[model samples]
Target: MSNRSHEVEYEQMLLSRHGLWQHKGGRGKDGPMERSAYILLSRIRVQGPMSIGELSDAFGLDASTLNRQTAAAMRSGLVERIPDPAGGMARKFQITDMGARMLDEKRDYFVQALDKVMADWSDDDIAHFASYLRRFNSDIERIEGRPWPRPGTDGP
Candidate 1:
């Protein structure tokens, strides 16, 4: 949890300081399109409705940059501006139902990719790995003031 340990982990995983950017999941994408899309969708899916400012903070980006990206998402009907769950003047941006469906599709794609990559492993191996991974992630979340990503979560 210290700066030194965090940097080491980032160096090992090729992750940025925020843990959103990683090299492992960057394969087979047109530029960073797939990565950007996946990360954006992941935040929206995990955090639920959020303001443009909140998204900017979560992704460590500028407002104008998200404005452009979210404009495209809005045009595609994948993202929508909605009443802020927090109830503020700023509108909360949320993934539409269509967006959620697309997220599910991408989730399946990632799951399939993971399955193929881990195909040699036995069922017990898969289950064991999954359990430990969950525990590791839960500990990280406890440190970060965030909840583990999953359905029915209160936050991302």
Candidate 2:
């Protein structure tokens, strides 16, 4: 087996073993907010005040699907939709202060949950894994599209 093929297979196996597919239920087969909502919030955090159409395009989802999730978020006061300041077509959605606060709280919960869940792991090991996992995510985004999660960093 070639080195590149082996590496690809290893990564695939690792992802399959631990990705959303391996959870008790299939992705979005179980979540209340729907995975679409999560992606919307994440993109909103990164991109800021994007129109629904743009979000739909970025995630390869349809406007209806995106609108459904955005509607739910709006009802919950997690997002706010406003007229596009520049005026053109689609209205823009922005995360509210409440939404940002919720994201931060969720992060803290994740940290605590992982710490308790991995109580036996050494601090150094955990830190290393966290850093590498973050880098891996960043690299995958670059591979899939371009330098994102840090816009415009991809060199010439």
Q: Judging by TM-score against the true structure, name the best candidate.
A: 1
lDDT string, candidate 1, 47-74, tens digits: 6777889877776679999898888777
Model 2, C-alpha of 131: deviation from truth (Å): 3.5
TM-score of 2: 0.63
Per-residue CA lDDT of model 2 for 15-76, tens digit only, reads 65654423332222222333455557767787768897777667667889888888998886
**Whole-model alpha-carbon lDDT for candidate 2:** 0.68
Cα miss at 143, model 2 (Å)? Answer: 3.7
Model 1 segments beyond 4 Å from truth?
Answer: 1-33, 127-152
Q: lDDT: which candidate is best? A: 1
Residue pairs with backbone atoms closer than 3 Å in model 1 (clashes):
none
